[model samples]
Target chain A: MAVYTEVTDEALAEFLTHYNIGSMVAFRGIAEGVENSNYALKTTQGDFILTLYEKRVDPADLPWFLGLMEHLAAHGLSCPLPVRARDGKNLNPLAGKIAAITTFLPGVWPRRVLVEHCEPLGAALARLHLTGEGFAPKRANALGPDAWNDLLQKSAPQADSVQAGLGRELDSMLHGIVANWPRGLPSGHIHADLFPDNVFFLDGEISGLIDFYFACTDIYAYDIAICLNAWCFEKDFSFNVTKSRALLRGYMAHRALSEAETAALPVLAQGAAMRFLLTRLYDWLNTPPGAMVTPKDPLDYYRRLRFHNAAKGAAAYGL
Target chain B: MAVYTEVTDEALAEFLTHYNIGSMVAFRGIAEGVENSNYALKTTQGDFILTLYEKRVDPADLPWFLGLMEHLAAHGLSCPLPVRARDGKNLNPLAGKIAAITTFLPGVWPRRVLVEHCEPLGAALARLHLTGEGFAPKRANALGPDAWNDLLQKSAPQADSVQAGLGRELDSMLHGIVANWPRGLPSGHIHADLFPDNVFFLDGEISGLIDFYFACTDIYAYDIAICLNAWCFEKDFSFNVTKSRALLRGYMAHRALSEAETAALPVLAQGAAMRFLLTRLYDWLNTPPGAMVTPKDPLDYYRRLRFHNAAKGAAAYGL
Candidate 1:
């Protein structure tokens, strides 16, 4: 783990003074994440999460994260509400890191997820997409196709070894995607990293969604593609069409996809697969030993990429 | 994107002093990564790469990264040789971050990989597995089954909403895999990441390999499984038995699998598929918007998981 900066108890206490919470209790040295240092903190008023800006998180991007949380909260989205600082600011500085406190959402992460949960999640995601309209942020999609090409170049020197074949495939795939790229879907603020850990549930209902760090402007359907990748697969890496339908139906209930968006689902799915495959590939190649962070298997994404390549239409997704 | 620490020209100059490389003539920032800051540096002596410990890299793990590089270089693996410090140490602190410089290998990443490449890659992977026999600096497999379970827990809350029957199916699959988990196979250090970008080629032959960060102690055949997932699939994600055969032949040429290992290959591939599916699922649920990282489609892995689940024997892989 990279401990770029540490928040001392005194510093945390002082920083908490600015918040509207009644009292402060802090847990420091939380897990090291790529984007933020998250501490589980408690206050007299309520439990909250204190996030220190890790090196990977740009200070300039803090407002977007904070504002998105506030926006989602304001729109009746079940999510953590950012607490204001003493100066009435949602963003604050603590221990040489940009910091913020958010109301802690309550729920245990599910031990075993069931098929029935997809509908609500799909609905919630659609709601999130709808709520993201008009959200003003300066940042753009970070992991778009151009960025993938650049990553390939960095790893290009080693491309011809046994695995070098993947580079070629990825290059061609990227070009294919670009040439046939879908244009002009409903674009909005997207929760780019809506992985399971970031979502909080109460009973069977989604009580809260957390971790808005990777949120950015992109095609709305792309988020659905992300969810399809996330929710419609079994443990053995098999696609469950039933699950795909449920998820898509759930989303459609809240916000219907345009004809173009529906048509682009398969291609979008392929792009999504390529995106992850490239990242996993990059991580697999560059991850150093003993970094504590695990690099995901590139083959996983490779398999997904291949599937998307073969997929004929969005009908497979029931979109 | 995350400049955890800036490396001054002087610091880079100091780094070059110990290496037998020539003058530092060029430095280019690689903008593709979400983890570290990499600069493609050219020295009068030869081309090299300078990697500054960025967000995801732990400073404490610098020695392990450096040592691994040195070890591989010593063994005639055509990888980057880390330049040691003036104190004869491979690890060193430069600027505010730990950094290392390594000799660059030669090769262009293939723009399109042919099925023929699989043989060399498979063979190279087998050689890598064999050579990893007693290499020191032990590390645990990062994303084994246990990690998959953990991700399941995290993503469980949204299970019902994301897929219709996926949660139940996933649960069943997990139970099945756990119950039928293979007992044993040749275990050793495995290059968990055998993706194409990490391999270097000269002409049609593999010249070298790079990126040992994800190397860990695990089942050797699992490494083969990873390679199969990476190399044997077509653009449309269908299994190519011909490619699979060539890859297996290459792998067998270097390190013949035990009967037990061969017998376990299909199941191992299933497990590999599941591992990827789970991670992709997790990423799908948690991706934040606007981040440069792309979330992969879970369905691709899901289908693969199903294929592996149905695969009854090693012959399925043309072995």
Candidate 2:
């Protein structure tokens, strides 16, 4: 629920001159996504999404994000392709920030997670990984395990302020996970943040995958591990085994997991949980006064991490 | 930049059962308008705006607002027409709040108001008045002069806090205007808040007039007064006589103003300014802690009120 920047009508009209898209007909800021300002634009050509990258997004990484979307869309993944400007570049300058327009995908992200959503999401994840094989540009998973130490250091000072001794507990967990972190068996570009909100569904099927800001080259099985934590958790913090099995089986239907990938699931899942937990904790502690966004509770991931800790192996995740 | 209510996928799906607009293709909360939760909705039928009435808007006034849009659109005014459901009701309930879908109008609101925009706006406003002559449900101008006393009472306590002696100045102005408030100046349904943001433009022509939540029976010239304060003011708070003349001429081309209406212009404009000033002042003082909205500067209206006070007559506005 963020549109941090306002693009004036004159600015938008001038910006559109760089594109081959028809004259702008309508545009309204979209109240979704926190990292950038998004507007649903309608032109004589068609409907598209105009994204103005905010400060949180590095301008340098935009080409990678835009290129990845272009490659994936071309390879038959249902996702938005960045619209190339008249100069043959998808990334362009507008309103003092890097901005780009992408073809608008039509579908609503599922609000109520169901078993039906899990399978399609798993299949789409595999497809995206497969389709992303030949993308020329690459970005490292910035929130991966290697970066967890810095996040922990930043969040450590105020962690217990959220809950008593929460800082100590997280510190202990981080050390254990870092010490035993697995060498990934499979690695490629993965949608590091494939939360339900980023997956669109229509008529009980996954229609598109979106929000590739966090997409990066990472352990592919670790990507599955992230989903296991993200999609397989319930509102009361209970594990939904049926949904886990559905997601894993759905992924296996497309790309079978090697034995090493399967064996590494628990440790990978713990690392994934730690990744989100630390980031959320940092945001929870550092959200500026009067921010429109509600910082997600880091404790949610703490609970998920506990579940992953208790689970023995990939069998526990129905892999 | 407001979407106060969160409409879940399940609730939206259930709500659509009442409509015959085909299956929902996409829905994104629109980051526009301050008083309601608006979603840019697309379905198998076409694009539309789905609004969930927030607490700021009176639930009782929903019928009049919806009916006014229906009447004006049917009478050939380019505005959003309320879409009737399968049961033929323009107003319905969803997510425990009053909600309805209206056909989406395509155009961008003029961010930089120009003289060209003023003419079409004036003409369209006059047509809205003419076409609204027979609207069945009547809504009184809730923010008219009669309501100013209560608003002043609520805001007067903190008035001087915003500016030195501002409270005393507004108090003096309110008394004079209330004593000499114009009477019987050819009243009818008027778009009371026809701000530039509500008027959409495409290709240098007015495409539609929208945000009819404030439509009510008021002196038609008072609507012009509101526009004069809204559209004829530059960023530096100076009046633009050229735009004002264009607006008056455009309105007269459609529906001529009576001599009495013209004579009442200065006082009506002053009253219009006071109405906004008081309401804005109240909002400024009463906006809850941590509320997402940024309260508008009450002094903007106070500055306009000073302009209206200095004007000798309608001629000062190029009428």
Query: Highest lDDT: which candidate?
Result: 2
Q: Model 1's CAPRI class?
A: incorrect
- Error (Å) of candidate 2 at residue B12 is 2.8
**Model 2, CA-based lDDT:** 0.88
**Candidates' C-alpha lDDT:** 0.71, 0.88
**What lDDT tens digits, residue by residue, belong to model 2 across residues A1-319?**
7788877788999999999999999998888887889999999998999999998888888888888888889888989999999989888888788899999998998777888888888888888888888886678888888888888988888888998998889888888998988784778899998988788888888888889998899889889988988899999999998999999888988988889888888999999999988888898888764576767888999999999999898888876
Q: Write the per-residue lDDT of candidate 2 for residues B36-150, one digit (tens) a residue.
A: 9999999998899999999889988888888888888888899999988899998888888999999999999987898888889889888888999988667888899888888
Off by over 4 Å in 1: A1-5, A26-34, A159-164, B1-319
* Alpha-carbon DockQ of candidate 1: 0.01
TM-score of each: 0.49, 0.94
Model number with the top DockQ: 2
lDDT of 1 by residue, B96-121 (tens): 76677777665433334567688998
Per-prediction DockQ, in order? 0.01, 0.57
